[model samples]
Target: MIIRLNDMVFYGYHGVNDEERKLGQRFIVNLEMQTHPETDSVIKRLEDTVDYTKVYAEIREIMESRQFLLLENCANIVADKLLTDFPLIWKLKLCIQKPSVPIQGILKSVEVEVQRTRE
Candidate 1:
């Protein structure tokens, strides 16, 4: 089974620039998780599957807890926590977006994607 949480927006002070750290910006998180639910059985109870609300809470906690210098680092932290906290999650793909990048060019947003699988 798969669980996807898309377009989760949060304001976090995560960037290499000093200004960005002081004045936070919006961060969009997209997480896709592959889980090992009972394939042959019905998911009658919430515990039978991954609770996305709890997953969202964890992600929010990670994003809101501290400042990060790079989106890659943030993604890594999130992936590690998720994989560790939820053993059912066999794999995950996390994407973070920075819309207001302090770059000298026209762009939609700066995005970083990371994929992790449990060994």
Candidate 2:
């Protein structure tokens, strides 16, 4: 089964510039994972499948734990954490968006997407 989480937004200090880091900004995160239930029969219980609430909590923890200079690093960190925390998840895709980037041009947002699988 495939599980997706979209537009999970958070305020964090992550950027190359000091001002951006100090001021912080809104970050939108999209996460997708491919996995299956431990049991062969229908997944009737939460214990048989990956718990997305726990996953969201983990993402929130990672986003709030520290500062990152690059969104790539941030996404990678999330991917690593998810893979480590849930062994049943074989593949994952993560996207992070910086909506209020300090750029001269009028752009909606800057985003980075990353895909990872258990090795």
Candidate 3:
């Protein structure tokens, strides 16, 4: 089974610049998760599948927990936490977007993506 969560926005203090860490900025996260449920029968109960609510809460907690210098670090933490917390989730793709990047050129956003699977 697959579960997807898209456009999860959060304001966080993450960047290399001091101003960015102090001011913070909006980050959009997209997640795609693949899970394996016991048996191929119809999944009738919440226990049979991964609870996305818990996943969201866990992600929010991680995002808001502290400041990081790179989005890659944040992505790694999210992937690690989710995979560790939920045993059913076998793989995941995570994308994090920094909408307001303090750079020289005008661009839509800067993004970092990572994929992880259970070992």
What are the per-residue Cα lDDT tens digits for candidate 1 across 1-119? 77899999998999999999999999999999987654426666887777899999999988877899999999999999999998778889999999999999999999999999888
RMSD per candidate (Å) reads: 1.4, 1.8, 1.4
Estimate the TM-score of every prediction. Answer: 0.94, 0.92, 0.94
Task: Please give, for residues 1-119, the per-residue lDDT of candidate 3 as tens digits.
Answer: 87999999988999999999998888999999987644326667988778999999998888877899999999999999999999888889999999999989999999999998887
Weakest lDDT window of 10 consecutive positions for candidate 2: 35-44
Candidate 2 clash figure, as a count: 0
Ranking by lDDT: 1, 3, 2
lDDT tens per residue, model 2, 1-119: 78899999988999999998898888999999987544435666787667999999999988876899999999989999999999878789999999998899999999999999877
- The residue-level lDDT of candidate 1 at 62 comes to 83
Preferred candidate (lDDT higher): 2 or 3: 3
Q: Positional deviation of 114 in candidate 2, in angstroms?
A: 0.6
Angstrom error at residue 52, model 3 = 0.5
Question: Looking at model 1, which ten-residue stretch has the lowest summed lDDT?
Answer: 35-44
Q: Model 1: clashing residue pairs?
A: none
Better TM-score candidate (1, 2): 1
Query: Local distance difference test, per candidate?
Result: 0.90, 0.88, 0.90
TM match of model 1 to true structure: 0.94
lDDT for 32 in candidate 2 is 92
